[model samples]
Target chain A: MSRQPRASGYFRTSYQADRALVATRLERAMLVLFVVLLLAFPLFASAFLLDLACQVFLASIGALSLMLLTGYAGQISLGHAGLLAAGAYSVGILFREVNAPFWITLPVAALVGALLGLMFGLPSLRLRGLYLAVSTLALHFVVVHAGAEYETRRGYSTGVIIDPPQIAGLAISDPRAWYVILLAAAAGTLLLCLNLLRSRTGRAFGAINTHETVAAALGIDVARGKLLAFVVSSSLTSLAGALFAYYRGFVSVEAFSLFLTIQYAAMIIIGGLGSLLGALLGAFFVTIFPYLIEWALAALPGAQRRASEFFAVNYAAFGAVMILFLVFEPAGLVGIWRRVQSYFLLWPFRHRPLTGARK
Target chain B: MADLELRRLCLRFGGLSVLEDVSFAVNAGELFALIGPNGAGKTSVLNCVSGLYHGEGAILFRDVEIGGYRPHAVARLGIARTFQHGELFAQMSVLDNLLTGRHARIRTNALAEMFGLPGVRREEARHREAVERIIEFVELERYRHAPVAGLAFGTQKIVGFARALALEPTLIMLDEPSAGLNRDEREDLARFILRIKHELGITMIWIEHDMQMVSDLADRIHVLDYGRTLAEGPAAAVLRDERVIAAYLGRAHARPAAGAAGGGAPGGR
Candidate 1:
């Protein structure tokens, strides 16, 4: 029998192109442009903008972790902020008490975070949906409380101080240098996550999310996959925390809280679950939303003095936006962008339909 | 020869007895059919054999005890099964759904997958080829890139069959393969079942409700009533048996009449 020729357009029929990170040449060019813009941001922006960008990078890492666990694996975790706190606190304590170098303490922090994730993930064997969400919520409160109490106990400390270490005779204490380092790390992590999603483990994760019983029937170890997802997600979040601690030169319990968990959840929701580009989009929206709101409010009369209340207003806006997006665009912003792209791609052929849309 | 033997398999759910002293042996290259009335625990039997449920008995896969093993372990031992409800991954494409069936045969490490190693690439290529062949076998080549959730019920069933076939399984278990199918779909499924046994020489254990299809396609039939094997022999002999006629067929045939008018005797046979 003669085999049919493989289709080779924007979409390739071969397995390699089907599983590629960037499917088309246009996507690759777009990615390169994004990188160049990111690299040039620190040079052109002010110190405040640089700091905001750093926060965005940190939040993006956390959002990426959530995307892997919730979006890809179909597992919900409300306690991820707890895992992040665990990592941040472990790094803080190690550097403060043991005098461990920043680079040396980073891996230890990830390990500790992974251990905590394992402990939390154990419940996943018997729990799912709202039950699992509640369990994780409990975990979040417990970790945040423990961190707050620990901080209070340490004498002469409003927050633990962190000293950045020198790497090969180059000091990393400067904010601009740290920003570059954080940017590199976040970008690498994102690439790693993207690569992972195209792999067997990622496929298994997707399979389990779609149908755990079917995945099990296919010889995918569902339990192991769930646990692995939790571990990887926690490790990434912890790495972000460790970097954030060193960059900020302090470790405060206030930084890691349930509100932060909600924010991360919001990021995944707004970006588009299970899409890497969605996570970055979500991070940008969440990080800049408050600033944008503040700026708009400052433009109004008698609003400059109410700047402190912007946090509450920002939260209200976040809630409103989340509800609006959930109602109108359940697939999030990425879904909308995909629809628009497909609409353009199929232009001039009115009846030709895109494949992914379910009838 | 790949054969499966269920040695006095018993399953109890909490206070309810679902399967009791159920024992059977399916030979290699045989189209063995299990016919039962509603709630006769036919699906439970499939679940027990496929390791979805732990039961008190020995399930021998070519003489190796596979009872109480995890589902993935059972699957790795060359046993594959489909669900009664056609459990296709709704969000994944048809090709992905078929690829999942070849998961047991494609052995690649997480590191290999991460870096797109040569081994992973080769295995992925092999899996894709096998999946494509199965898709062609099921006459679903057109829907290869289609999302399965939006397909017609009959097409979804074909996707399920293609997925099970992608494993190159030694013994494939089909759970109610013709549950919601029309006459044409049922005919297509019957032909596929016969093809699996005749052309590929793959052993099959199927649970089907359509008596006509069972009589035509099954080499042998096992009739179950209230968690026990009521009869076992050739399809003609079992279907014509007195006890099976009294318990299952009589009750099934009388359901429409009873629902038409006033209440009748609860145990109407």
Candidate 2:
């Protein structure tokens, strides 16, 4: 056994091999399979499932932005929902009042979101940790209250309605068509984020997060890096919000509540902080969980009527999952997955001496 | 003008005077050592020089008064420093941490970086080459991709030194570079210090407790006691002074045989 090659397929690497994301042909095939499954999801799933998937995609995008700021840059923000609301409301209002095209409205919304994020992030220079968190929380309330008032004062009888645009004379109003658009946007945002992470600015954010004092001593403008993180995070979140508004064809203050902020934070925590893959995984878990509970209740005898109670229970379950993960698995689901992968990868090696009888 | 000068530097923390009337000058290509017992304000002088603390006197670097400047602003003005306890970015890869040292030199604006403009990419590639050179110089190429937190203490110290070197500053201040290193690591650090002075041609102000290492590496030494400079001269002359011996050996141990009795090591306990 020692002389023979084991099934645990660990490959040695050259310099270039070490840098490759997927080290083996098998891993490359697995990635292809994953993409196929993602594309097939909307087709096979029910209407409720399609809606849930859209929510997951939207939340994933928002969480990705938060992960960049909190996980990589080490600056905690509790006002992300406000930024998202800023994007959604701005896009909704712009498209409704000015009759602007989606392409124009989208970039405008993102720019405004980034500006607001920078404004909120300015307080980070004077505060940090819990103090910064509190200041951002205040920002959330202020933005939400201001948004609520703005929506009321605008006096649009139907609120802001986002009609499907005639893109080259083809209307995109169908739910399936909107799903495809959202999926494309999510993929584009993810690719952009991935590229940023590999770039120098991403590394700077990580350095500032880890040790601002050392970063500054090393000639890094710590304050500027932090502000950039906030701006990027806000812009991404706003983009997601704008997509949400278009898909729903409406904008309301209720959609951007503090609970949504908590939900986004929970997604990042459970998926894994700092890891892009974790953001998507977290969004999946959070979005599907309530639907899963509803389905389970319907399946049980005489339990369908108690669906509202189950929804409440599901929220508590989400909070519990977050707390448990923070205490026991701070690396989140991605960390657990890596550990399991490594265990299988190192099988039959008996690296540790046997200290007890086999189970 | 001196490469770096601190004139009558005074620092107060609430009601306590941590540093008072402290003055020093480091010439170009000079290895100046600052020595003192615990709480004698050795690190305070470095903190003031590095702009980590507010001090009453002017800190002139290359004829520019840099007092009241922020740490990053001071660094941009060509002053680089290493913390007393290896303040490395734990989550960052060794190469990334080194690249951060070159941040002040990165002239690209945010818009350019975000857009991945041609000039920004070229400047980034140039900075990466410099960082790689520093990594090789410090013998940390093996751990170039590893996070600083995962590396050994000695390697982290070297990474800290590499980060300081990456700045290519006119003056470098190191606070206790050999604080937690073993004998072999200390010797390795000593060689690097000499290389930094001889090969790099950069002035350094180091606060160190290892007297023998100081005597071997430093061109001149400054002794501090109770926030005041008690002695300053060549390493050989400072080591032979009675007051220097008394400060390190204490008044009880400052006798004729004190040097021979193994009480000569600076910062004993």
Candidate 3:
């Protein structure tokens, strides 16, 4: 979460100290407070707020998956929502066909996602950057078409209706239960991503992204790293989609559109590419933004007249904000957050000399 | 026994030939030097051996054919290489970048590693200890945690050498390891190379246009001029050869850039 690689007075004498995620007492306290707040949230929050929290949790998982692949591995993908759809549709198809339980549906979703990841990753072996992005984009269309065809063939004209997933003979559709489950899922994913990044697997991703020739020369299997990244990221994303399907009790091809894919991409870019905190922050911002816009518009005098084109206004606003972030704050919110923290941390001392700059 | 052998190698781009029938053999525990003028395809020879380039020839290590293998597969057979332009992961810390050199040796399964399981964690500690020793050897402790991208060019080159050393390579190919280093750093590098050869018994292929470093450290010199072997023998014999003096030494003194390739230029890349 700290942007500075080395913070003031953070001397690490051992490897354990160097790798510790929470070093200072302040960080530990902050983490405790954060967890306490999260647990207590559902106790006092409104139903709508609880649902929003669930949505943010779901989006966090997908955003984290995208961050792992694109931010860390440096593999650009535009088929994220397609993978999500695959997961959701797998649950739908499996449940409708064999009366599959939630347990069966979730793993099936992950498996389908892994296979699709393999298919998508094959093209990355021969392409990079924009070309690879385009390849993923094309695959997204194919996946959406498959899901649409399934819906039409199954005679579900509107969309598939997913039953509330049950665990231990109890339904999980209660807002409180859903909130806790989603929170646990999001927390587990964050932990998983943190560990992977600190391991050799994550370093290989960074190496491949920085320089493919160098990565290969250093004995990293470039193709394997790329494919493994896709597999792991897609698996996590599909799992998130399965959770989404269960949360909403619905699965619709129309829901998983190109705009949805763009929104997920926006999450990573707006969050901060390499930082997990950025993904969570970006998810929070994107998920709550439309509501905020609607509220603000309602407060305006011409709200009734503007209601006709609210969707259009939302689309234009999102695009404009994305562009502004890209041009003015390339590092996203994390970068800006760090700069502000540094300013306060180093008050009365404006500039650090080159020798002192590292810490 | 020969540690590595490149036999009748040929590489080209379209109609332009980059390496023409280039053949060389490095012996066990020997520091072999490859010297040539710019665009003489010296780096190409290393590239072909490291599996970065596809050439028409056979490359053998320990009597096993490795010509067409991928770079990682070849590296798994205990060969390591450094780049001329410092092809390092710039955003990563020096320690992280060096640990990457040991990627081939890490055999933990993905599942085990994902959870930071006991086996991989212990393995990581061992590798980290080795990397720390390298950081000490190169005197880069101050920059160990700093990103390689922000380090000075000379320090980055030192990090590059330390990274290759981290591989514990049996056969190390150093492509201009001391390119941008200062006098003190170059001297330290020379000492490191000497210790690596005499103490560790690692075979090395040292490429450089700096004749002094090459002649001082190399057991043998293989000279190239315009993608052709100009001379090959003991350092003293090759240094004295008329053709070597005329083709390489004479031009290097006239124009230094003529000896160092303009990295990633429109040449054989």
User: Which prediction has the highest lDDT against the true structure?
Assistant: 3
Q: Candidate 1 residues B1-269, lDDT tens each? A: 54999989999999899999999999999999998878899999988877889999888999999998999988888888899999888777788788877777878766566566777777877788788788888899888878777789998998998888988899999998987888799888888887788889999999987777778889999998899999999988988888987876565566777434313222233
Residue pairs whose backbone atoms clash in candidate 2: none
Provide the clash count, candidate 1.
Answer: 0
Error of 1 at A325 (Å): 2.3
**Tens digits of lDDT, candidate 2, A1-359:** 00111133565444334434456777789878988888888788888778777787788888888888887788999998888888888888788678888889889989987998899899998899999998988768877777677777888544577787668978788767777777777777776676566556776787787777777666677888889989998888888888888888888888888899998888889988878888888888888877776777778887867766886887777778889999998988877765555566456554521211100
Rank candidates by TM-score, best first: 3, 1, 2
lDDT of 3: 0.86
Which DockQ values do the candidates obtain, in the order shown?
0.42, 0.31, 0.52
Instruction: For residues A106-143, write the lDDT of model 3, one tens digit per residue.
Output: 99999999998989988999999999999999768988
Using TM-score as the measure, the top candidate is 3
Query: How many angstroms is the interface RMSD of candidate 1?
Result: 5.1
Question: Which docking class does model 1 fall in?
Answer: acceptable
> Highest DockQ: which candidate?
3
Residue lDDT tens for model 1, A40-131: 88889899999999999888888998899999898899997887887788878888788898777899988887877787888887899889
In model 1, where do residues sit more than 4 Å from their true spots? A1-8, A11-14, A149-156, A348-354, B115-118, B250-269
**Cand. 2 Cα-lDDT:** 0.79
TM-score of candidate 3 to 2 decimals: 0.95
Worst 10-residue lDDT window, candidate 3 chain A: A350-359
Q: What does candidate 2's lDDT look like per residue over B1-269, in tens digits? A: 58998899999999899888988888999999999877899988877877779889888888888888888899988888988888887766677677777778777765555555667667776787788788777788778767677778998999998888888888899989998888889888998999889999989999987887988889999999889988999999987788887776444444445444543445332
